[model samples]
Target: MDLDEAFELVGEFGPRQKRLTAFLVLLQVFVAFQSMLIVLVGAVPEYHLDLEEIPASREVLAKHVRFASNFTSIATEWYLIKHDAYKVSLAASLYFAGLLIGNIMFGPLSDKLGRKPVYLTGIFFDVIFGYVSAFAPNYEIFAISRFFVGITNGGMSLVSFVLTQEYVGKSFWALTGSLTNLTFAVGIAIYALLGYYIREWRFLAFISNSPGLFFFLLSFMLPESPRWLYSQGRTAEAENVLQYIALGNGKERLSVKLKQCIGAVKKDDSESGVLSLVKHPVLRWRTVILMYIWSGRRKSTTAFLIFAGIACIFTMCLPENRGGFFFSPSILALCGKLTVSAAFNIIYIYTSELYPTVVRNAGLGVCSMTCRFGGILAPFVPSLKTLGPSVPFVVFGISGLSAGFLTLLLPETLNKPIAETIEDLQTSTYQMLKNKKVNQLEENS
Candidate 1:
């Protein structure tokens, strides 16, 4: 009984698998809170950059307050870093920068060392960074803390999702694949709900980061992956984990299934790394297309579209003196925000399906890295207030349009079994071509 066979024998997703997967999925919600907390923590209220330049008179301050009304964000409680729009955007971007770095480092590490250690290390960092950012006394300190949060969140999101999906049987692959998106939605919703009431950025950070402690404490309840252990040639440990699973699942064929899975394990000697993503014929193109379409990448059309759309709305909301609609611009902005969220959710599921299991974490890591870079660029987009409206739109619009066309090049894996090895990826194409040849011969006969 090979590992694939053992998986099939388990008879679809059972209660034990369901319980374990549910815990794994919760990791995403926590990740979302840490990463997306910037939406609240970085919210800069109305601020006057020229305050010191102007007089200290009440009339002068009042006049500048009216002048500052041109900006977006609240004036509630900005760290000293809040004086400039570009600076504020950069402060928000530091978290994403951390995310990119984290993904790059941890993806390969998990592939080398197994997922649990890498994942727990990330969660531990996520909590520490979250609190550090909350209590950071200065802007530079806050940004540094956010960078670590990004690192941990990026590592956790990529490796954890790949790990969870690896344990899930194929019967529920597509269904389970979308669970991260659901949890992310829940996390973002909670962030918005808290932001509405808390209003203070640091307080929001405190509440959000506190959950990581619970996750870290509960981490012991979960076991290291049996599949990962088997892949690394730790057959004894793998069997022990499998036996433990069997007890909860009430399946009697644990020994038989364990032997089958272990006997079939094959070790690959190739020294492939991130560069290997683009080295294989099929994987190279697959990696390219996935990066192009990944919703998080800076080149993503959704960001440009949303940016352009929001810029257009802000134009309409501009006063008649500024030559605009002057009516409330709330609904259109809300819809645009929702559209961006939906596109990202779709990308998360799509990227996971496209890559084979061996390189799944690495592939996601690269995509995640690009996405963070895009996020880094996103802050500057709002600072383009000096460039006039059409400039930002044109820049983002072209990227978005190009991404849409690029998405059409990738293979659809809606019903396909996920490839577990480079051989699987390479051969699937050959099998298709062989079938085509057979059909042509049959027509002649």
Candidate 2:
């Protein structure tokens, strides 16, 4: 029997199964560390350096502190070095561009290579670039590092969704997917609480990066996805790996099923590539919509977030213009950051389950790209502060909500076997929608 047949024959087991399952959960820590590192890129150490001890007014102090928290800020400082607003906007734009380039490449890679290897490689790049960013002697190098970091780190983010979904039993897919992104929310919450105590920018950079070393070690302990191995026609190795997984999970060895699965494996499958994706109508449509959604979501979130942060900064920087009770702009920025972080995690779970496995990576990639692109547009909301804060929020909120509505177009894949190809996807959907009405009529008898 195949693995599916074997699952049916053996049926589900009990508490001992839970003990074995613990090992799977343990693997997520490495992915989670990567998530935490990517988010910390925004609020770096230089942000707090000069201002923390300044005796001058907020505006004067901000200038002393290098008030340029992003790449735009860096650029402005480089040229119009004294113009804080221009610099802030410029820095935000640069970060968005980084995400755009990174996201464009991350999907194809995960699709071509198995999720595990690509994920580890991405993390390695992130740690290396992140350290380089810390020592960047100038704004241009810093921007270059940030852009590369975004690309590498962007790939790292996708693996959590892919790996967790690939390895676990179908029943646990939603929960694992949700928690994988939820790591960001948790990271943001921790960052918020810690931000007050840790004001030095460089020290913060050091602390943020320290987790990556642990990931470098933890990657060794993670098993490559058996699903990927099987797909690649490495059945013997896949089976051995699966046996260990079963053993680790306290289940009986499934040798016969492994043999059956291996026998079923055939070569000459469709390779994942840009051309391959574009050639198929279903994948083509899925890719376009997903990319639109991904780009829109990223732009929307980033635009609103930077808008809010800049507004708060302006408030703190100007006394005559300062309105209301005073909380430092940094603290306010933390609030916005944490809010976006929570929203991102919640949205990803919903998006991840929205496609069949045949196109899961493709679909998720499109959606993720949408989110990142929305963030890219986020930094450019100049009129929002000049016009009103509510303006940007409303615009972004509407854009995100619109993406949520588009989500309804997708079917939920929870508890379903992962589809293997476009044909599998079509047949599965046909049965779900087509057979349902027929079954209902027959049931009336």
Q: What is the C-alpha RMSD of each candidate to the true structure, in Å?
A: 7.7, 9.4
Off by over 4 Å in 2: 1-81, 84-92, 256-271, 292-347, 350-359, 379-405, 429-445
Q: Give residue 358's error in model 2 in angstroms.
A: 5.9
lDDT of each: 0.65, 0.54
Judged by lDDT against the true structure, how good is candidate 1?
A: 0.65
Q: Which stretches of candidate 1 lie over 4 Å from their true place?
A: 46-87, 199-201, 233-239, 256-270, 295-343, 378-405, 429-445
What's each prediction's TM-score? 0.74, 0.67
Tens digit of lDDT per residue, candidate 2, span 33-53?
334433433433234434345
Q: Name the candidate that leads on TM-score.
A: 1
Tell me the tens digit of each residue's lDDT in model 1 across 9-74. Answer: 653467777887887787777787886776666555555545656444544444554323322232
